[model samples]
Target: MEMVYANRMTMQTIKSSTQDQNPPTSPGDQHSDSGVVKDTMAKRSTLSETVNQLQTNYSSLKAERDELLTNYSSLKAERDELLTNYSSLKAERDELLRQLGSKVEICEDLFALQIFISMFHNFWIGLTDSNEEGTWKWVNGTTLTT
Candidate 1:
Protein backbone atom coordinates (compact mmCIF):
# COMPACT_ATOMS: atom_id res chain seq x y z
CA MET A 1 0.00 0.00 0.00
CA GLU A 2 1.04 3.59 -0.50
CA MET A 3 0.90 4.30 3.25
CA VAL A 4 3.44 1.58 4.00
CA TYR A 5 5.81 2.88 1.29
CA ALA A 6 5.57 6.46 2.61
CA ASN A 7 6.38 5.34 6.17
CA ARG A 8 9.43 3.43 4.92
CA MET A 9 10.72 6.43 3.01
CA THR A 10 10.23 8.73 6.04
CA MET A 11 12.23 6.39 8.28
CA GLN A 12 15.12 6.30 5.78
CA THR A 13 15.15 10.10 5.53
CA ILE A 14 15.26 10.48 9.33
CA LYS A 15 18.20 8.04 9.58
CA SER A 16 20.05 9.88 6.82
CA SER A 17 19.63 13.23 8.54
CA THR A 18 20.79 11.77 11.88
CA GLN A 19 23.90 10.37 10.30
CA ASP A 20 24.68 13.77 8.73
CA GLN A 21 24.41 15.44 12.17
CA ASN A 22 26.78 12.98 13.87
CA PRO A 23 29.07 11.90 11.06
CA PRO A 24 32.10 9.72 11.94
CA THR A 25 35.27 11.87 11.94
CA SER A 26 38.99 11.03 11.86
CA PRO A 27 41.20 11.75 14.89
CA GLY A 28 42.76 14.64 13.00
CA ASP A 29 39.38 16.25 12.39
CA GLN A 30 38.47 15.92 16.05
CA HIS A 31 41.68 17.57 17.15
CA SER A 32 41.20 20.45 14.66
CA ASP A 33 37.60 20.99 15.79
CA SER A 34 38.72 21.04 19.42
CA GLY A 35 41.33 23.64 18.64
CA VAL A 36 38.77 25.79 16.82
CA VAL A 37 36.43 25.63 19.81
CA LYS A 38 39.24 26.64 22.20
CA ASP A 39 40.24 29.52 20.00
CA THR A 40 36.65 30.73 19.79
CA MET A 41 36.26 30.58 23.57
CA ALA A 42 39.44 32.58 24.10
CA LYS A 43 38.28 35.27 21.68
CA ARG A 44 34.91 35.49 23.40
CA SER A 45 36.57 35.98 26.80
CA THR A 46 38.80 38.75 25.51
CA LEU A 47 35.88 40.52 23.90
CA SER A 48 33.87 40.27 27.11
CA GLU A 49 36.72 41.79 29.14
CA THR A 50 37.12 44.58 26.65
CA VAL A 51 33.44 45.39 26.81
CA ASN A 52 33.56 45.51 30.64
CA GLN A 53 36.54 47.87 30.62
CA LEU A 54 34.88 50.18 28.13
CA GLN A 55 31.74 50.30 30.25
CA THR A 56 33.79 51.26 33.33
CA ASN A 57 35.55 54.02 31.42
CA TYR A 58 32.27 55.36 30.11
CA SER A 59 30.87 55.50 33.66
CA SER A 60 33.89 57.44 34.93
CA LEU A 61 33.70 59.92 32.08
CA LYS A 62 30.00 60.46 32.65
CA ALA A 63 30.63 61.17 36.35
CA GLU A 64 33.37 63.66 35.49
CA ARG A 65 31.08 65.45 33.06
CA ASP A 66 28.41 65.74 35.71
CA GLU A 67 30.89 67.19 38.20
CA LEU A 68 32.13 69.75 35.69
CA LEU A 69 28.59 70.80 34.90
CA THR A 70 27.90 71.34 38.58
CA ASN A 71 31.00 73.48 38.94
CA TYR A 72 30.04 75.53 35.90
CA SER A 73 26.61 76.21 37.35
CA SER A 74 28.13 77.33 40.66
CA LEU A 75 30.57 79.63 38.93
CA LYS A 76 27.84 81.14 36.83
CA ALA A 77 25.76 81.82 39.91
CA GLU A 78 28.69 83.50 41.63
CA ARG A 79 29.37 85.67 38.60
CA ASP A 80 25.74 86.76 38.47
CA GLU A 81 25.77 87.65 42.19
CA LEU A 82 28.94 89.67 41.75
CA LEU A 83 27.45 91.54 38.82
CA THR A 84 24.37 92.38 40.84
CA ASN A 85 26.46 93.69 43.73
CA TYR A 86 28.59 95.78 41.39
CA SER A 87 25.53 97.39 39.83
CA SER A 88 24.13 98.20 43.28
CA LEU A 89 27.42 99.79 44.40
CA LYS A 90 27.64 101.82 41.21
CA ALA A 91 24.11 103.16 41.72
CA GLU A 92 24.84 104.01 45.34
CA ARG A 93 27.99 105.90 44.39
CA ASP A 94 26.11 107.90 41.77
CA GLU A 95 23.37 108.81 44.24
CA LEU A 96 25.88 109.91 46.86
CA LEU A 97 27.77 112.05 44.34
CA ARG A 98 24.49 113.63 43.21
CA GLN A 99 23.51 114.47 46.81
CA LEU A 100 26.86 116.16 47.43
CA GLY A 101 26.50 118.17 44.17
CA SER A 102 30.09 117.21 43.43
CA LYS A 103 30.64 116.04 39.86
CA VAL A 104 33.83 114.34 38.73
CA GLU A 105 36.08 116.93 37.06
CA ILE A 106 38.36 115.73 34.30
CA CYS A 107 40.98 118.16 33.05
CA GLU A 108 44.66 118.72 32.45
CA ASP A 109 45.00 119.49 36.15
CA LEU A 110 44.18 115.87 36.97
CA PHE A 111 46.88 114.58 34.61
CA ALA A 112 49.37 117.06 36.02
CA LEU A 113 48.52 115.99 39.52
CA GLN A 114 49.11 112.35 38.62
CA ILE A 115 52.50 113.19 37.13
CA PHE A 116 53.51 115.30 40.10
CA ILE A 117 52.43 112.62 42.62
CA SER A 118 54.37 109.98 40.71
CA MET A 119 57.46 112.20 40.72
CA PHE A 120 57.34 113.13 44.36
CA HIS A 121 55.98 111.54 47.52
CA ASN A 122 55.54 114.65 49.73
CA PHE A 123 55.24 118.21 48.47
CA TRP A 124 53.17 121.34 48.95
CA ILE A 125 50.83 122.21 46.08
CA GLY A 126 51.05 125.69 44.54
CA LEU A 127 47.34 125.84 43.70
CA THR A 128 44.35 123.87 45.03
CA ASP A 129 40.52 123.96 45.55
CA SER A 130 40.33 122.16 48.85
CA ASN A 131 38.39 124.97 50.50
CA GLU A 132 35.68 125.02 47.83
CA GLU A 133 35.06 123.34 44.48
CA GLY A 134 35.87 125.52 41.42
CA THR A 135 37.54 128.15 43.72
CA TRP A 136 41.31 127.69 43.30
CA LYS A 137 43.33 128.71 46.35
CA TRP A 138 46.98 128.77 47.35
CA VAL A 139 48.49 127.04 50.35
CA ASN A 140 48.63 130.46 52.08
CA GLY A 141 44.79 130.53 51.95
CA THR A 142 44.75 133.18 49.22
CA THR A 143 42.07 132.73 46.47
CA LEU A 144 43.48 132.61 42.92
CA THR A 145 41.92 134.92 40.32
CA THR A 146 41.73 133.84 36.70
Candidate 2:
Protein backbone atom coordinates (compact mmCIF):
# COMPACT_ATOMS: atom_id res chain seq x y z
CA MET A 1 0.00 0.00 0.00
CA GLU A 2 1.09 3.57 -0.58
CA MET A 3 2.46 5.30 2.50
CA VAL A 4 -0.21 8.00 2.28
CA TYR A 5 -2.99 5.43 2.22
CA ALA A 6 -1.45 3.46 5.07
CA ASN A 7 -1.06 6.59 7.19
CA ARG A 8 -4.65 7.60 6.52
CA MET A 9 -5.88 4.18 7.59
CA THR A 10 -3.93 4.47 10.83
CA MET A 11 -5.45 7.88 11.57
CA GLN A 12 -8.92 6.54 10.84
CA THR A 13 -8.31 3.70 13.26
CA ILE A 14 -7.23 6.10 15.96
CA LYS A 15 -10.10 8.50 15.32
CA SER A 16 -12.77 5.81 15.39
CA SER A 17 -11.38 4.39 18.63
CA THR A 18 -11.42 7.81 20.29
CA GLN A 19 -14.90 8.91 19.17
CA ASP A 20 -16.39 8.32 22.64
CA GLN A 21 -13.82 10.56 24.32
CA ASN A 22 -14.22 13.37 21.77
CA PRO A 23 -17.05 14.14 19.38
CA PRO A 24 -16.28 14.86 15.75
CA THR A 25 -15.96 18.54 14.98
CA SER A 26 -17.36 18.91 11.49
CA PRO A 27 -19.74 16.87 9.35
CA GLY A 28 -17.18 16.39 6.55
CA ASP A 29 -15.22 18.08 3.81
CA GLN A 30 -16.48 18.86 0.29
CA HIS A 31 -13.84 17.00 -1.69
CA SER A 32 -15.18 14.24 -3.93
CA ASP A 33 -13.86 10.88 -5.12
CA SER A 34 -13.78 12.11 -8.69
CA GLY A 35 -10.26 13.04 -9.77
CA VAL A 36 -11.63 16.16 -11.45
CA VAL A 37 -12.02 19.24 -9.29
CA LYS A 38 -14.60 21.93 -9.89
CA ASP A 39 -14.66 25.49 -8.64
CA THR A 40 -17.89 26.36 -6.82
CA MET A 41 -18.68 29.39 -8.95
CA ALA A 42 -18.10 27.52 -12.19
CA LYS A 43 -20.40 24.73 -11.08
CA ARG A 44 -23.07 27.24 -10.11
CA SER A 45 -22.81 29.03 -13.43
CA THR A 46 -23.06 25.77 -15.39
CA LEU A 47 -26.16 24.77 -13.43
CA SER A 48 -27.76 28.14 -14.01
CA GLU A 49 -27.15 27.87 -17.72
CA THR A 50 -28.57 24.35 -17.88
CA VAL A 51 -31.68 25.47 -15.97
CA ASN A 52 -32.21 28.42 -18.28
CA GLN A 53 -31.96 26.22 -21.36
CA LEU A 54 -34.42 23.73 -19.93
CA GLN A 55 -36.87 26.51 -19.12
CA THR A 56 -36.67 27.79 -22.65
CA ASN A 57 -37.25 24.34 -24.05
CA TYR A 58 -40.18 23.77 -21.68
CA SER A 59 -41.84 26.99 -22.71
CA SER A 60 -41.43 26.14 -26.36
CA LEU A 61 -42.85 22.66 -25.88
CA LYS A 62 -45.73 23.96 -23.79
CA ALA A 63 -46.68 26.47 -26.48
CA GLU A 64 -46.63 23.72 -29.10
CA ARG A 65 -48.86 21.48 -26.99
CA ASP A 66 -51.29 24.31 -26.38
CA GLU A 67 -51.44 25.05 -30.08
CA LEU A 68 -52.15 21.40 -30.85
CA LEU A 69 -54.95 21.39 -28.26
CA THR A 70 -56.47 24.51 -29.77
CA ASN A 71 -56.36 22.98 -33.23
CA TYR A 72 -57.92 19.75 -31.99
CA SER A 73 -60.80 21.60 -30.33
CA SER A 74 -61.37 23.79 -33.38
CA LEU A 75 -61.33 20.74 -35.64
CA LYS A 76 -63.82 19.00 -33.38
CA ALA A 77 -66.14 21.99 -33.60
CA GLU A 78 -66.13 21.66 -37.39
CA ARG A 79 -68.51 18.74 -37.41
CA ASP A 80 -68.47 18.66 -41.20
CA GLU A 81 -64.73 17.97 -41.39
CA LEU A 82 -63.86 14.49 -42.74
CA LEU A 83 -62.99 11.85 -40.13
CA THR A 84 -59.62 11.27 -41.89
CA ASN A 85 -58.52 14.87 -41.23
CA TYR A 86 -59.36 14.61 -37.53
CA SER A 87 -57.59 11.30 -37.19
CA SER A 88 -54.46 12.57 -38.93
CA LEU A 89 -54.31 15.71 -36.78
CA LYS A 90 -54.79 13.67 -33.62
CA ALA A 91 -51.98 11.35 -34.69
CA GLU A 92 -49.67 14.30 -35.24
CA ARG A 93 -50.50 15.68 -31.80
CA ASP A 94 -49.89 12.33 -30.17
CA GLU A 95 -46.58 11.97 -31.95
CA LEU A 96 -45.49 15.39 -30.71
CA LEU A 97 -46.36 14.52 -27.12
CA ARG A 98 -44.60 11.17 -27.37
CA GLN A 99 -41.44 12.81 -28.64
CA LEU A 100 -41.58 15.31 -25.78
CA GLY A 101 -42.10 12.51 -23.29
CA SER A 102 -38.97 10.70 -24.43
CA LYS A 103 -36.93 13.91 -24.28
CA VAL A 104 -38.04 14.53 -20.69
CA GLU A 105 -37.22 10.94 -19.78
CA ILE A 106 -33.75 11.28 -21.28
CA CYS A 107 -33.10 14.47 -19.37
CA GLU A 108 -34.29 12.90 -16.13
CA ASP A 109 -32.05 9.87 -16.66
CA LEU A 110 -29.05 12.10 -17.32
CA PHE A 111 -29.69 14.15 -14.20
CA ALA A 112 -29.99 11.02 -12.10
CA LEU A 113 -26.73 9.68 -13.52
CA GLN A 114 -24.97 12.92 -12.63
CA ILE A 115 -26.28 12.79 -9.06
CA PHE A 116 -25.29 9.15 -8.67
CA ILE A 117 -21.79 9.79 -9.89
CA SER A 118 -21.39 12.71 -7.50
CA MET A 119 -22.74 10.77 -4.53
CA PHE A 120 -20.53 7.80 -5.34
CA HIS A 121 -17.51 10.10 -5.44
CA ASN A 122 -18.24 11.84 -2.14
CA PHE A 123 -19.60 8.92 -0.13
CA TRP A 124 -16.29 8.17 1.63
CA ILE A 125 -15.53 11.75 2.73
CA GLY A 126 -17.02 11.44 6.17
CA LEU A 127 -15.46 8.17 7.40
CA THR A 128 -11.83 9.35 7.64
CA ASP A 129 -9.99 12.38 9.03
CA SER A 130 -7.99 14.94 6.96
CA ASN A 131 -4.53 13.71 7.96
CA GLU A 132 -5.16 10.32 6.35
CA GLU A 133 -7.12 11.90 3.57
CA GLY A 134 -7.57 10.62 -0.04
CA THR A 135 -8.28 7.14 1.21
CA TRP A 136 -11.53 5.55 0.08
CA LYS A 137 -13.44 3.03 2.11
CA TRP A 138 -16.70 1.29 1.48
CA VAL A 139 -19.49 3.60 2.64
CA ASN A 140 -21.32 0.89 4.57
CA GLY A 141 -20.39 0.83 8.27
CA THR A 142 -18.86 -2.64 8.06
CA THR A 143 -15.07 -2.86 8.01
CA LEU A 144 -13.38 -4.67 5.11
CA THR A 145 -11.89 -8.07 5.98
CA THR A 146 -9.20 -7.72 3.30
Candidate 3:
Protein backbone atom coordinates (compact mmCIF):
# COMPACT_ATOMS: atom_id res chain seq x y z
CA MET A 1 0.00 0.00 0.00
CA GLU A 2 2.83 2.47 0.81
CA MET A 3 4.48 1.98 -2.66
CA VAL A 4 1.15 2.42 -4.40
CA TYR A 5 0.48 5.72 -2.52
CA ALA A 6 3.97 6.98 -3.48
CA ASN A 7 3.35 6.19 -7.17
CA ARG A 8 0.01 8.04 -7.14
CA MET A 9 1.60 11.14 -5.58
CA THR A 10 4.36 11.13 -8.30
CA MET A 11 1.73 10.90 -11.08
CA GLN A 12 -0.25 13.82 -9.62
CA THR A 13 2.94 15.96 -9.48
CA ILE A 14 3.85 15.13 -13.12
CA LYS A 15 0.32 16.07 -14.26
CA SER A 16 0.49 19.40 -12.43
CA SER A 17 3.94 20.19 -13.91
CA THR A 18 2.76 19.43 -17.47
CA GLN A 19 -0.36 21.57 -17.02
CA ASP A 20 1.83 24.51 -15.81
CA GLN A 21 4.24 24.16 -18.73
CA ASN A 22 1.53 24.15 -21.43
CA PRO A 23 -1.05 26.76 -20.47
CA PRO A 24 -4.17 27.38 -22.61
CA THR A 25 -4.19 30.33 -25.09
CA SER A 26 -5.90 33.31 -23.46
CA PRO A 27 -7.57 36.58 -24.62
CA GLY A 28 -4.40 38.49 -23.60
CA ASP A 29 -2.39 36.77 -26.36
CA GLN A 30 -5.06 37.74 -28.85
CA HIS A 31 -4.81 41.36 -27.73
CA SER A 32 -1.01 41.28 -28.18
CA ASP A 33 -1.39 39.95 -31.69
CA SER A 34 -3.87 42.72 -32.45
CA GLY A 35 -1.36 45.33 -31.27
CA VAL A 36 1.26 43.97 -33.67
CA VAL A 37 -1.24 44.07 -36.49
CA LYS A 38 -2.10 47.68 -35.69
CA ASP A 39 1.60 48.62 -35.77
CA THR A 40 2.03 46.98 -39.18
CA MET A 41 -1.02 48.81 -40.52
CA ALA A 42 0.29 52.16 -39.28
CA LYS A 43 3.65 51.59 -40.96
CA ARG A 44 1.96 50.73 -44.25
CA SER A 45 -0.21 53.83 -44.01
CA THR A 46 2.84 56.04 -43.50
CA LEU A 47 4.63 54.51 -46.48
CA SER A 48 1.57 55.02 -48.68
CA GLU A 49 1.29 58.66 -47.60
CA THR A 50 4.94 59.28 -48.51
CA VAL A 51 4.44 57.72 -51.90
CA ASN A 52 1.40 59.89 -52.57
CA GLN A 53 3.26 63.07 -51.60
CA LEU A 54 6.14 62.17 -53.91
CA GLN A 55 3.72 61.61 -56.79
CA THR A 56 2.14 65.01 -56.26
CA ASN A 57 5.56 66.72 -56.20
CA TYR A 58 6.57 64.95 -59.36
CA SER A 59 3.48 66.21 -61.17
CA SER A 60 4.07 69.76 -59.99
CA LEU A 61 7.66 69.70 -61.20
CA LYS A 62 6.59 68.34 -64.57
CA ALA A 63 4.17 71.20 -65.02
CA GLU A 64 6.85 73.74 -64.17
CA ARG A 65 9.25 72.18 -66.61
CA ASP A 66 6.68 72.34 -69.40
CA GLU A 67 6.06 76.02 -68.72
CA LEU A 68 9.78 76.75 -68.84
CA LEU A 69 10.10 74.91 -72.13
CA THR A 70 7.35 76.99 -73.68
CA ASN A 71 8.97 80.22 -72.55
CA TYR A 72 12.34 79.11 -73.90
CA SER A 73 10.83 78.37 -77.29
CA SER A 74 9.20 81.79 -77.45
CA LEU A 75 12.44 83.54 -76.54
CA LYS A 76 14.34 81.51 -79.11
CA ALA A 77 11.90 82.57 -81.82
CA GLU A 78 12.31 86.21 -80.87
CA ARG A 79 16.10 85.92 -80.97
CA ASP A 80 15.96 84.38 -84.45
CA GLU A 81 13.76 87.21 -85.71
CA LEU A 82 16.13 89.80 -84.33
CA LEU A 83 19.11 88.12 -85.99
CA THR A 84 17.34 88.14 -89.37
CA ASN A 85 16.50 91.82 -89.07
CA TYR A 86 20.11 92.64 -88.15
CA SER A 87 21.45 90.78 -91.20
CA SER A 88 19.07 92.66 -93.47
CA LEU A 89 20.08 96.01 -92.00
CA LYS A 90 23.80 95.20 -92.36
CA ALA A 91 23.34 94.32 -96.03
CA GLU A 92 21.50 97.58 -96.74
CA ARG A 93 24.21 99.60 -94.96
CA ASP A 94 26.95 97.90 -97.01
CA GLU A 95 25.19 98.73 -100.27
CA LEU A 96 24.78 102.36 -99.24
CA LEU A 97 28.47 102.61 -98.30
CA ARG A 98 29.54 101.22 -101.70
CA GLN A 99 27.35 103.71 -103.58
CA LEU A 100 28.69 106.59 -101.53
CA GLY A 101 32.30 105.50 -102.26
CA SER A 102 31.63 105.42 -106.02
CA LYS A 103 29.99 108.88 -105.96
CA VAL A 104 32.90 110.34 -104.00
CA GLU A 105 35.38 109.08 -106.68
CA ILE A 106 33.49 110.86 -109.50
CA CYS A 107 33.80 114.39 -108.00
CA GLU A 108 35.62 116.82 -110.36
CA ASP A 109 37.22 119.43 -107.98
CA LEU A 110 40.36 118.10 -106.29
CA PHE A 111 39.81 120.26 -103.16
CA ALA A 112 36.19 119.25 -102.95
CA LEU A 113 37.11 115.63 -103.41
CA GLN A 114 39.76 115.87 -100.65
CA ILE A 115 37.28 117.52 -98.30
CA PHE A 116 34.65 114.92 -99.03
CA ILE A 117 37.09 112.03 -98.44
CA SER A 118 38.25 113.57 -95.18
CA MET A 119 34.61 113.99 -94.05
CA PHE A 120 33.82 110.42 -95.03
CA HIS A 121 36.88 109.15 -93.16
CA ASN A 122 35.92 111.16 -90.09
CA PHE A 123 32.33 109.85 -90.24
CA TRP A 124 33.56 106.26 -90.51
CA ILE A 125 35.89 106.76 -87.54
CA GLY A 126 33.11 108.31 -85.47
CA LEU A 127 30.71 105.46 -86.34
CA THR A 128 33.31 102.91 -85.28
CA ASP A 129 34.32 104.94 -82.17
CA SER A 130 37.97 103.95 -82.57
CA ASN A 131 39.02 106.21 -79.70
CA GLU A 132 36.68 104.55 -77.11
CA GLU A 133 36.96 100.89 -78.22
CA GLY A 134 33.13 100.90 -78.54
CA THR A 135 31.57 98.73 -75.77
CA TRP A 136 34.33 96.13 -75.49
CA LYS A 137 36.65 96.43 -72.54
CA TRP A 138 39.44 94.22 -71.17
CA VAL A 139 40.38 93.47 -67.61
CA ASN A 140 44.13 93.44 -68.29
CA GLY A 141 44.32 95.60 -71.48
CA THR A 142 43.98 92.41 -73.63
CA THR A 143 40.41 93.47 -74.77
CA LEU A 144 38.32 90.28 -74.82
CA THR A 145 34.91 91.93 -74.37
CA THR A 146 32.50 91.14 -77.23
Compared with the true structure, all predictions reach lDDT values of 0.80, 0.63, 0.70
Which predicted model would earn the best lDDT? 1
Model 3 stretches with alpha carbons more than 4 Å out: 1-29, 102-123, 127-146
lDDT for position 5 in model 3: 46
Candidate 3 per-residue lDDT over residues 1-146, each given as its tens digit: 45544588899887877745434477645454676887899999999999999999999999999999999999999999999999999788778978876331344466876887876754321123344756444323454333
> Total backbone clashes of model 3?
0
How well is each residue in 52-80 modelled by candidate 2, as lDDT tens digits?
A: 99999999999999999999999887865
Scored by TM-score, the top model is 3
Q: What are the clashing pairs of model 1?
A: none
| Cα RMSD to the true fold for all candidates | 13.9, 39.4, 12.1
Full-model lDDT, candidate 3: 0.70
> Which is the winner by TM-score between candidate 1 and candidate 3?
3
Model 1 residue 121 lDDT score: 71
Candidate 3 TM-score versus the reference: 0.52
Residues 1-146, model 1: lDDT tens digits? 35544588899887877745555476645554777887899999999999999999999999999999999999999999999999999899889989976444333476877986786675556688877899999766888766
Question: What TM-score, computed on C-alpha atoms, does each candidate reach?
Answer: 0.50, 0.30, 0.52
